[model samples]
Target: MSVPPAPALPVVGDGLLDRLLPSVATSLGVAGLARPGDRVLEPARRAVVVLVDGLGAELLARRGGHAPYLRGLAAAPGSRSVACGFPSTTATSMATFGTGRLAGEHGLVGYEAYDPATGRAFNELSWEDGPAPRAWQPHPTVFEAASAAGVEAVRVGPGFFDGSGLTEAALRGGRFVAASSLAQRVDATLAALRTRPRALVYLYWGDLDKVGHVHGCGSWQWGEELEAVDAELRRLAASLPPDCALHVTADHGMVDVAMDRRLDVAHEPDLAAGVAEVSGEPRSVQLHCLPGAVDDVLAAWRGRLGEDAVVVTRDEAVSAGWFGPVEDRVRPRIGEVVATMTGELAVGDSRRHRPELLALVGLHGSVTLDEVAVPWLCAPARRA
Candidate 1:
């Protein structure tokens, strides 16, 4: 007997995140943003979206023993996690989630985006009073609608993120509640929920991502962080008011890219030829080619990368619906060629940035299920 082939690539409408957006928007009472769904979460007084960074569906399942509470939630009915769009990184994924739009519409192309206007590669998440949020993201977040529709909207996270560029770009328009720890975030979320009859609280946790970046996804440190996240989720769920509901999800997942498998484009002269700039993480790369070098660039990369990655021309990705319906405005943000790693790796030029990026133990920014599938754990309304 032979094993069946893996399921087909996820379609735009069928992915987990696409289906959950409407339910979430409806529960929060934001009129137009939500898609159609059964309003199972009743009482609808308040809704919370707990975003756990790096907790992908596959990682949550394989590493569930470390996260008992979260695991239980996934096992429950009406609880599911879905794959995020291409280049499963936090910046792009969060923008997709906050806007209810695909990456193509939102223009948050990746973790390290080459801003077309500036022609510079910068970390969007680490922006510090440098760029204008509206100019950078140029998309209206769902929070904007929540605030306009008279729902009390709030963002609960670390004090450092009170006005970070990514927060403002993808999740601004809500009141910021600064908290230092998971417990504080939980307390903040509950307080925000009860402040008004219609409220939308967006809570964030970064422990899992932090641990996974430092230690591999299979490490003891990552496990401990998952346990802490699980405990916090359970605490938040139990403390919700009678009319409230909680939706726990994540930005992306993690995969351990062995150092030996990493292909350093800087070292590979053929792969680097005609390539103007390289952006994205170790697992995914967007290669911008010089004028009229697009074909040569693609052929060279496809020939060199071989089976280690999937090398698709920008048009191919756009036509294939990789980033949802590609918008004209987003075309420039995408490169002439996009390389998504499958079994091997794509490394950054350590000479270009910090050493820590190269040293990261766990990584993402690929289309693989391990990096794209995120869990959506919903807690039924307490008094419904």
Candidate 2:
């Protein structure tokens, strides 16, 4: 009898966003970094990583027809689907991607992570009223590492990101080149590559994720955005130098949750009872409990959410490899009781969350396959 294939590596460590950049740095001959996924990339003098926010592997598979260029790259050799890990939101995933370290080590564990030092939750994406960004996440980014090793590192994204606290914390190494539109960003990327023989460039796009949050991931608008991205990337691919390689990836995937299936904690006394705070996103609800209230809060959330969510104690979640070796410093940021929503169900708080945010068509930040599975697609540039 033929032997079954060996079980895949756990999504927490090996096949993850934390390793993608290290692999890229490795392929570019950057020294002093261990390359866990060395073979995930091919050796190249120049590399361009295009991070399409909210582009999940499963979503791309289901909507392949709308993104032919990206779909073809996914089908190419060396292309595979990798996990974005637990709490698969942009802030967490970007910390993982930029630092080549897991959320536990990076300490930006959630979109709105609780800072034990300040005794308050802050929006990691916005970095408003948060702890000093450098003090929060002190890891040297892969960009910084690569630059130190003599590779030119550049980041091409929105102008507002140019010296933002989030940039200072996680992505501080690279020179920032702001481009407002996709076309401008693409042009900027091509120009940046031409300036140096060995360079690591990053291009960020968010319109797809914006469309998904407002119009739903499966909506025609999202499909059209995908098509537009595919067309733009196709144009980019044709202009790439032969010595370069292009890697396309994402922060997380999304799933649409109907308003009827959502629970508003402010509207439900039982759900909000003993929770000191609610910090995480709708799909992944983190409930910080009052002193001596862990068990009660866990039980209450469990009984209330039922099969709609998998409720767990903070200790239980860490043991389950959810955050991938969380450090002691990062422990309190996680809640006493955490709930990962199941199916299309979600829990939001009308009191804590804005009405517009609660009305978002698509939601993420959970361990579902749709939320964690991101594409690891790569292709070489055209011949000169």
TM-score of each: 0.93, 0.95
Q: lDDT, candidate 2, residue 124?
A: 86
Worst 10 residues of 2 by lDDT: 1-10
Question: What lDDT tens digits, residue by residue, belong to model 2 across residues 1-384?
Answer: 122222222463237877888888888999767654345456799999999999999899999999999999998987888889778899999889999888878888888899877777888889989888888888899999988999999999999998888888888896999999999999999999999999999999999999999999999999999999999998888888999999999999999998899989998898888887888889998888888877778777777888777888877787777887898888999987778886789888898788899999999998888888899888965445
What is the alpha-carbon lDDT of model 2 when measured against the actual structure? 0.86
Task: Put down candidate 1 lDDT per residue, 55-173, tens digits, no spaces.
Answer: 98888889899888888888888687677887689988888888777788777888777767777677868963335777767867777877888988898999998778888888777
Off by over 4 Å in 1: 1-8, 11-22, 36-43, 128-131
| Per-residue lDDT of 344 in model 2 | 80
Candidate 1, position 207, lDDT: 85
Q: Cα lDDT for residue 301, model 1?
A: 77
